[model samples]
Target: MIKLIAIDLDDTLIAPDGHLPEENVTALAQAQEAGVQVVIATARGYAGTKRFHDQLGLTTPLIVSSGSNVIEGRSGEVLRRRFLPLPFAREVVAFAQAHQIALRVYVGNEVWNNLDYDPSNGRQRTVEKQVEQMAEALVEAPFQIFVKGNRESELILAQFGEAGEGYCCRHHVYSDGISELNILHPKSTKHDALAGLCAALDVPQEQVMALGDSKNDLGMIAWAGFGVAMSWASEAVRAAADWVVPADAQRLTSDPDAEVAEAVLRHVLHVAKDKKSS
Candidate 1:
């Protein structure tokens, strides 16, 4: 029987407009009431993810920064963290500065950026400080780095042989004109983090369900006992999922929030019942 449920944030749980549907809220509440551990696994930082955790009143630890950091929700204590090696981080910073790529570096609780702030960027907190001297400012190893711009610019970042080798890189296309490259330690993956979480909870990997909608979500989806993909997920994401919820079924005639809630509730009920009967 499934003992844990891990959900992705963007494009999976939250709508494109950044709103969490009421349906999803209710379904998750029901799951918690049923004694299943719910975990939010995302590429977002703690500051960005805190609101969702608070909204759900989650007590379990949260997987953040694409699994580079896992922290307890209520107590706000860091459980695990993987930081980029200092030399490698410096090399990445130097490369980004040389190419004039707009970059953001996450170090502990702070975020440093090289670009002007814009509300539409979707980053929950404002950049704490601007890196005037990228090299000097990046002395400490960062948990993650975000590079934003066109594909060509991100491709340029892929050239740092050894420096890039030690890190897991994810490319995201926000629009025709905007793309983002996320860098984290090679070991920092949702699957790895979930494994740790399961061990802590004394649950097996086969007793966990994961839900997601993007390439970054593939690891956990593949690792979970039951992996669910959203209807609008990419072809790769769909292929990785054990089940796919059709867009129409997810939304029905209700709002996106309600649709998500209903879909989650239906799936959870069926799975739990099946497990019990078997």
Candidate 2:
């Protein structure tokens, strides 16, 4: 039987404008009431995702920073953390600086960036500092580095071929034509973090359902027992999912009565109920 549900934040759970669909909110409450554990697995940091967690009243540990950090939701205690080596972090920063690309470095609870304002498309928890100052402040390894620009991720990958040997990289292109590059330790992935979470919860991988809509969410979608992809997801993401939600079900609208959330949750609830019955 399904015991856990891992949902992504952007596009999958919330509308493009960043509002949670009421249908989704009600569905999530119903799932919790049914005793199924729900957790958020997103590339967002704790600060970016905290509001939704609070809104949902989540008590489970949250998988943030694309799985580099997992913290207890209720107590705000760090449960697991993985960092990229200091040398790699330095190399990545220098490379971004040379390319004039905006980079955000996540170290513990603070987000360090060279830009005067948050460069991660309005993400929260940021502190502006010069690249040199940010590099020097890396007393320990950072959890992850995010690069934002119009450049394709493959270009960055090729440039870091040798330097990023031990690191893992993923990219997501937004609807507004901006692409983001995420650099992290090789072992830090949503799938790896989910494994750890499963271990802690005594739940098997086959008993979890994962929902997402972007390339960064591919790992978890493929790893989970039942993987769901949003209708507007990229071809690559749609191909990887076990099920694909229709566009009508995920309409891009400002309507408060939109049923995107309800459509997504109904499928999950049906599968969970079937598992229990079987």
Q: Which predicted model would earn the best TM-score? A: 1
Clashes of each: 2, 0
lDDT of 1 by residue, 108-196 (tens): 77787765442226455465587768677776889888876665345555675323567767777742447767788988888899889
lDDT of each: 0.76, 0.75
lDDT of 1: 0.76
Q: Once model 2 is optimally superposed onto the true structure by TM-score, how far is the C-alpha of residue 1 displaced, in angstroms?
A: 2.8
Best-matching candidate per lDDT: 1
For candidate 2, lDDT tens digit of each residue in 46-69? Answer: 877888898987889999888989
Kindly report which residue stretches of model 2 are placed more than 4 angstroms away from their true locations once superposed. Answer: 115-117, 121-131, 151-155, 161-164, 248-265, 271-278
List the candidates' TM-scores in order.
Answer: 0.87, 0.84
Off by over 4 Å in 1: 115-126, 161-164, 175-177, 249-253, 256-260, 271-278
